[model samples]
Target: MAIGKLFIGRKVRELRLEHDATQSQFAERLGISLSYLNQIENNQRPVSAAVLLALADKYGLDIAELSTGETDRLMSALTEALGDPLFESYSPTLQELKLIAQNAPGFARALVSCHQAYRRNSEQLASLDDRLGRAAALEATPYDEVRDFFHYVDNYVQELDTTAEALALKLGLQGGDGQPILTDYLDSQFSVRVVHGPSAMNAVRRYDPAGRVLTLNPYAPAETRTFQMAVQVAQLYASEAVENIVRQAGFRSEEAGEVCRIGLHNYFAGALLMPYQGFLKTARDLRHDIELLAARFGTSLEQVCHRLSTLQRPGMKGIPIFFARIDRAGNITKRHSATKLQFARFGAACPLWNAHQAFETPGRFIRQLAETPDGARYLCLATHVSKGVGGFRTQRSSHALALGCEISYASAFVYADDLNVTDKSAFEPIGISCRICERSNCASRAVPPLRRSISVDHNVRETTPYQLS
Candidate 1:
């Protein structure tokens, strides 16, 4: 019979240090030789079953739990990092990665983090060039700066989240819909009367601080009204927290700060309307049916999607999902991800993406299984949302929203129920955007990839004008 080494040397050493015990003292206590104890602590020898029991008896330690699938997770992350084209020429073997994961987990984690940061910066650079047509990001606009801020943060603002969660509890959002509770809160707290009617200047929400009147657009749906009321509450009550965040952000322009402040207010509103813990529980319970979630929380589909993306609390994380809204023109207006999939920052999204197709089939969900150029597969869901002025004269505001996650998480979503997720051929090939897309034969590519050599044979007709080399 053979017992494998735990590879939890650092953990054992840490526990010993916590108890202020030397190797000899720990060895004496565990009834093992000092050299054996040293070998175990250095991951050079197996931690015997007897020694494990002794450590538990002596130190109240769960040493076996220390190595519970950590090495596997680390290896998986390392493998994905190596799968990047940047490491293609010099990627270490899988055995080396596994050894690093087992013996030097901390170093392995640090390497993964560094690679992520490097990749993020590179994407930002490419995005800056795409959006602003400039080399330096200093020239970026307020919207650009704010979008990047949220993108880097994984779209979760913790302080604001806590504040909103507390507010949701105080307002009793979990037990009921957001409308009545939020309206009563505004009335009692600020002496503000919530009047639903056509607001001045066709605004969705207008708060007159002096008059203490909150007017909402009558044409807007009940969900919109409730959400705007929450936003007003945030503006009224969560002003300090919002300002603190804006100040700490150190945005280059006051305009960016203002934009960020409004964005925070909206974020607080979403969190308040659908409090994190409650929303997460319900989402999981309902298997993340967007319509069901929307009905439960009294929020719009887009709101639910956006809130789901922010369910990234430290210990109680929801599915890591990417959410975005795109206009008919193919512009990604709002984008955030708690997953590996990021939206194209510079231009319109890929033409073949489900979000674009959403505009064609309004009021119905469009599900897609797609693979990016980086070999990442996702289960994408898209639908269009329309906000009409209740008449034909005024234009109707509509946009397509998309929610997605990697194929590994597809089973958890109701939208993926009928998808041929296991079949590679069923997944359509897609990209972030054509300019940065490395796919050589994308039929929908509008522009050539950046920093890549391409061949243009005018005589030979291909899917794209330029062939990626």
Candidate 2:
């Protein structure tokens, strides 16, 4: 296989600017002429091996950062944004999009942000018309605000993860028996008693601060009980830290702030449960096996998958994966990505995703070599997870959990063991949503693509109702 030339002139210029050095000075440091450096900065020339070595030698730069997956993420976002009906007439080439993403990342991100805001406003107006003035204000929803915050930060909060790890260490939550350690920590530190409450309480965990009593529903699974206890511990001991982080988020509304605070507390709880170093090592040793890791850590499968997505701690990073939880109606209730895959913010996910099929096949794992419309490939794993109340008359909530990473990391996943990742025929084509999908011949498309005109021929009906014109 031939290696492609690396055109990271924009990254070079970014590094130069970060060091506050002019082009001439930086070029001199790299032992290159000012004219040559200018050519590279403008992306007229590829970054040579000599320049790469010079960059490392002089600046001590991690050359890997030059190709950090940010450009791919930006390109995907830009492509989705440009797929809007408003940009139907303009179709830029892939090279042009790549150039824009690499050389003008801020502009690319701003375009994505603007498109998101437009979509939010459009949805609000549509809902308002349907409800006939039900809402009193046209403000951003709390979910949208918090989702945007995490999206902007690439779904990783470094300070919070660090604090949680330190807290875990202080409480001696290293290897064995997480639940007991947590229970003892609560009792010893806060004088709180941990007790199992009746199933009729209809809550997983409830804490009475005044009485210093924490109760967990006995019907809940052991993993759920332990997680609830961890969450309560975070609330009692890490409230100030969580509040400080939430304050720094600069949320627009008090409701959003509170919601974000609760979210951060949950994040701290997960981090404390699965401390980064131990979890990463275990994941690697298990070949990223979800069930084995879950049993080893005494956590649920969903918890292990979610924790894997958050293993993005600077130099000690794990495989970048996207995690999503979807209900039977195909509504995505929880979503985060450390990869280029982003979920549709307002609607259900693509029907072709294996996650939806997981609901039909309970207690079975669905493995897929899936490709998005952007041509990116991933090894997708999905399974159904059900949470039920103990009694017969009580309700149960069933959801499908999806976890995946780019195909380049397929070797690290146990689910990909029997598959040949390089075989193009094995990959199933999927999309983020039908409205934004560009596939013209999709049989399951419920809606016409926004960027393409639809032709409805009365005489000739295809797999889909309409043909792309």
Candidate 3:
């Protein structure tokens, strides 16, 4: 293999560039010389265990992600992108391009960035064109805005979680067995009637303050119910507190602030459902099994997953886990985590995870072992969840979520012990890193890593180039 075509090296160079570090500056940080760094990027040197460890500890990059070059993800993205009609002219030459991706790292990055810029610009242009005024029409409903806000925060806010916890304790609503579902608690304790009915409109959840009642469909999944309760709780108890946080955060727009307020409400509802200690105990006893937890609490898998992520209480923390729900089309609809996974800031996720695969095996829980660029491995459990539309359309849809943690903690839980296969090696290893993975060797990757170069030369296209940056 030609030198300067290494994924790890390319990543090192990108990070060095991002920090604006001269080779010497980066070398100093790694406690290595410029020559050693050069050797690593050039594929002349293998990444050392010491340096890998340092990257994890010092830079906060997951060690497993760094080492394994989760190529499945990269190739998947590229394949999807290449499938577009815009790329049809070059479709016949994809094999050549893939080879370039493996052999010439610089060109691979340039292409990825170029494609990203193109997509962004196209979206902006499409928005501006606004043929049917769809943007404005959707804006009339707060749905898109709220979704965007929650999506922006990845559905978990540490500050809000803390506030909810304090409030739950102060209100004597923090017990495990005693805690009731939000609607039930409201109706039984506060004389509020909680029921399920068709929304007069498309309102996901609504509270009738005048009627002193709350209504959500029995068909609603655990997540929907939890959200409803949160909305109701926010309307009833923490509206003022939510406003305070919004103001403190300096959100100038009233719309944005209101969205935060609603989110805070849901956060409280989740806390109420899963009181820190009570829920944590059950979760541990249950070995953090999601389906069992959902059944026990009358919540959905997503709700259980969300609660699991929030077990980040200072003294009583569960294993750090990442939760993501994606539709069949690969759009990540909801995501939250306290783990080391880095979601791509602006693009789709890797396609190989069970999150997407769950579509094929609906109602079945699938397990996968995923590695990040820094060589961190996690055992993931994924399942599909659905919701119903009550009225005329009577439409139904479903999505999938993957719940995972580092493999070291797998044996500690029942979910880990039941992967359908006893041998860990029998399970396949997958990855999620999009930018810096150097596994030119993988066939399942959607797109090659941005760190690899392209090879236009004849007879010697190295598998996705990891050029010495």
Candidate 4:
């Protein structure tokens, strides 16, 4: 296979501006002409090997920094944003979009922001039609803002995870039992007392910061109780580190920041419960078995699935998996993707996915060999998880947890052992969302695709009511 050229134009310009060097001065250091440097900076010419070597040798810059993952994210976001009906007449080619992301990333980000503002305004205007004379402000929801933040960061916080792992090691929380070690650590370090509160409190976990008391619902399962305790410990002990990350996130609203703080605390708790290296090694040894890993780590299946999605730690990365928790109503409550598959931003997931089917056979795993509309294949697994108070006649919550990775990694998953991964006929087709999917003959399509014209013919009928053009 032929390799693509590496273009570091944006990174070069950023470095030049950071060093406060003019074009001529910087070109002299790189042993290149000013015009050639300008060409490189404008992305008209790819960065030469000599220039890359000079960048590292002269400035001690890391060559890996030249390849910014932000360009790929910007490209994907711009593609989605431009898919709106407003840009139907001006569709840009993928190569053209790549140039925009590489050479004019700032302008590309501005365009995405403008598109988001337009969407918010359009939604507000639609709401205004329902309630006349009431002013509705245009704004992105806090959930969306936080989701976008994690999406751009690829859902990994290295510093916080590392700190949590170090704390785990320092507290002697190795292997056997994490709950008691965590409980003892809180008492010794912060003088905080962990106690079981009344089930009537109706809260999973509550911490009285002023009173130095940590309370948990007595009805929660043992795994849930321990996880909640870890969350509280993260909030109390890792506040400084979590606050620093939140401050640097540059969220547009305070609500977004607050939501991110809670998210980071949850992240720290997961890391504390399952330290990175040990968890990765065990996951690989067990062939990424959720049940065995949960049993070994003394965590829940949901916790194991969620932790697998966050194993994107640079040099020590694990399998790239997408994890989602969907309610019985088909709403995706929690989602993160380390793979190419992204969940829909708004509304429910595609009805075609096995995650919906998992709810039908509660507590049983559903394995699927699936392919997306984009032709990417995956080995998916989903199971329903339920939690409630430990008594009869109490409200219970049930949600389905879905975990999957690319079909190329199927051999590493024990669930794929019974399926034939090489057979093209075995893979079931799925889509990210109904609005964007191009599949025309779908029997379950609820609405016409946004980018395709539909034809309704009275003379003939098929699986679908309309044919897409």
Candidate 5:
């Protein structure tokens, strides 16, 4: 792949501020004129080779850190946000969006956040029951805040992941695997007791911090038990790392902090179960077969799918996959994308998506060739996953998981082997949501596009009754 030019304007500005240098002073130090330095700082021009050498020589900066990973993601998201009809009058050009993303990233982020708050408020107003109940809390809830935190960070927590990987290696002392290994680690390392009994009812797992005892539900699956144990182990063993990350997150409320703390622990547990390097090697070897990966790593199918999405370790990233889990009501409970295909922030996904069909054929994998309205093609794979404790009276959780990479990387996925990726006719059209969709003639649009000039003709209808101007 041909790499684009480096734009480290934000990094350069940060460095300049760290040294408390004016633009002129910084430019002089970098052997550049003030105007040229101004252009570079504003991302009007890419950092020149001379400037790069000057930075390396004078400041000992890492040139690799100049990549526009976060800026590109922000530009993409900001572009999508501007596409909403609410900004139609103020629709900026592509160049303007890039400048906003590179030069004033904080402002760009604020705009995106404001747009999210607007959409959330709009959605709430559309539902009377919810509006009546949640009208007081118009701002984002704790869960939404945490989800965005994960989304903007690319869903990878480096400090905790490395800590968990080290813990995994340390736990492999006795050479055993799965829950037995985790239980043994807890018992030997912390003088903790892992117990399963009929008394540890309803809840899947419970930990008594003061007593240093972990209780697992006897009825839960072995994988579930193992995962819970790993989570508890993470809470106990990786407390320092988790606390450091939580403090850095700086959530608005104590509830969000608590939620993030738990989430970090879960992330740690997942990383421990499937250490980075070993899991990546096996994933490439098996072509990312979720079932086989689950069995090999002693995890559930859902865990493997979720873990695949978090393989965003810099310099050793797995395939750029987008993962989402949706309920029967089409509510996306969990979502993260390493690819360009971002999900809708407030509503259900497009009806044409293959993930929705997974519920119809449980236990079967559904492979799809889908083209979004923006012309991006994806080789998507979806499957239904259900978990229960075993009794008819017991509760069971069921959701469909969708995982995929871009069509260009489909060769890395085993599920895409039989897919007709190149056949334009084989690809179904999808959109982020109908409200912002540019496709007016879509057969499955649930509602009309917001603020669009539409004429509904009772006598004639073409796919949809409301025709877009």
Candidate 6:
């Protein structure tokens, strides 16, 4: 028997085929000789960093996938599958397994898929346990802590939107790129200039009454501009009003109150740019085309998702979408959702979701159907967006945002209409539950969840310890 090579020739070849480009065309586009490109594709030559970057920039391959393969993604699935404390002893080996991913790419991918199956089973078991006292314990985790925080903050978003819209209306700043003009309005009306400086440089978009000119960093997004404007409005125009709201929240500390105050100010700013009624109308009209909505409202992709999550106004609520921002390593940094979908408290998400795939085709929209252990399915859509904290000359990183909902709500999204949804079986089944699945037949399980009991039948051996009938 021959040992298989670790080279990624097939994937490279597949990329070219997927884009419908000939070898010569790909070689020319990559600025490499046809023979050399052929050699690289054949695994005769390894791809260099320059070539890898070119491929990523040209073909839009996810940098993480191009570099780490699926090791990180697999690690996430494995971590979730090992929800049981019994696997704690194998943690070091798991770390080593990740390093091995660089050398054994095929094995890494296989582990990811296998781990996904294990997670599904664990989640199933967890669902059964949800009826017990476990529900309270589950609700008290760090994950729910943040989620409840966001839920409370969402109400603040609604109030701020209403107030900010009224303010924007009064100022007669309804359309066009309003940042500069809004800055000017603040300088003229409030006797303060907005100045931008490094976090260490004293102020981040600060108002300087002495300078008399609002100096904004070019790195700020349109939404940031609006946010800054709203902060200024709260400080100057609605200081008493903002204070009043904070007072009602009954925070134990001044710091918490201040944090909530600043957050509310930001909510107000988003509303100024995208007033609730108008933004929701456009979102519905465009069928939730994020790019179109971003352009029409002069906001960022994140801002659009954030706004979408807030369309939960009783009978007029839009199809609830959960928003999560994750890096290439599958680490979710920020999350907001109107739907019941709960993000992983700690560890990586399912590799099958569109969010994970967004890293592959940077700018394009990808959609998929995801299933939880409870047999709940959702339609997910994800895309990548980039932002900078400095000018064009400064370094910037790209981030991905994934938004999705239950499959029943698919008819409300334009992205769902464009997907191949006729074959329900073909749609990948995924889960948000990390510890309750009972598909004990999976080999990729890192650890059995704490709730499952292992049954031993020496004469009748099973693939996994736990059995669900």
Per-residue lDDT of candidate 6, residues 1-469 (tens digit): 2222334555678899999999999999989899988887766676776777788899987755554435466566556545544354565466455444544557766765776665454545444443331432233234343344555454334556677778777776564566776777777788776656453122236555565555555456756666666567666766666777778766555656766667666666677777777777888889888888888877778878877877776667777778888888877777766666666544566554678778789889888776666667788888988766565576667778999887777777888886655567856766553354444555545455446766666667566554544
Model 2, TM vs. native:
0.70
Worst 10 residues of 1 by lDDT: 130-139
Residue 397, candidate 3: how far off, in angstroms? 3.3
Tell me the deviation in Å of residue 81 in model 2.
24
Instruction: For candidate 6, give the lDDT of residue 211.
Output: 58
- Please give, for residues 1-469, the per-residue lDDT of candidate 2 as tens digits: 3225777887788899999999999999999999999989888888788888899999887865665478888999999999875686899899999889989989999999999878765654533432352323333678667866765566778977888888888877764458889889899999999999772278888788798999888888888888888898888878888788788878878989988987887888888888898889999999998999988888889889888988888899999999999999998888888787877666678989999889889999999999998899999999999987478887989999999999999999888889999999999999987867788878889877656788898999789877999
Off by over 4 Å in 5: 1-139, 173-176
CA lDDT of every candidate: 0.83, 0.83, 0.64, 0.83, 0.83, 0.66
What is the alpha-carbon RMSD of candidate 1 to the true structure? 23.8
Q: Which 10 residues in a row give candidate 5 its minimum summed lDDT? A: 129-138
Residue 281 lDDT (model 4): 95
Model 3 clash number: 49
Give the TM-score of each candidate.
0.70, 0.70, 0.60, 0.70, 0.71, 0.62
lDDT assessment of candidate 3:
0.64
Candidate 2 error regions (>4 Å): 1-139
Error of 4 at 168 (Å): 0.9
Per-residue C-alpha lDDT of model 1 across residues 370-441, encoded as one tens digit per residue: 998779999999999998645567678789999999999999999888778889999999888776778877
Misplaced by over 4 Å in model 1 are 1-124, 127-139, 198-201
> What RMSD value applies to candidate 5?
22.6
Alpha-carbon runs more than 4 Å astray in model 3? 1-115, 118-204, 218-227, 418-429, 457-469
* Residue 276 CA displacement from its true place in model 4, Å: 0.3
Instruction: List the lowest-lDDT window of 10 residues for candidate 3.
Output: 132-141
lDDT tens string, model 3, 195-306? 6676523555666778886766655554566567655765676666676766775453577667667666767778765667767888888888777887776566777887
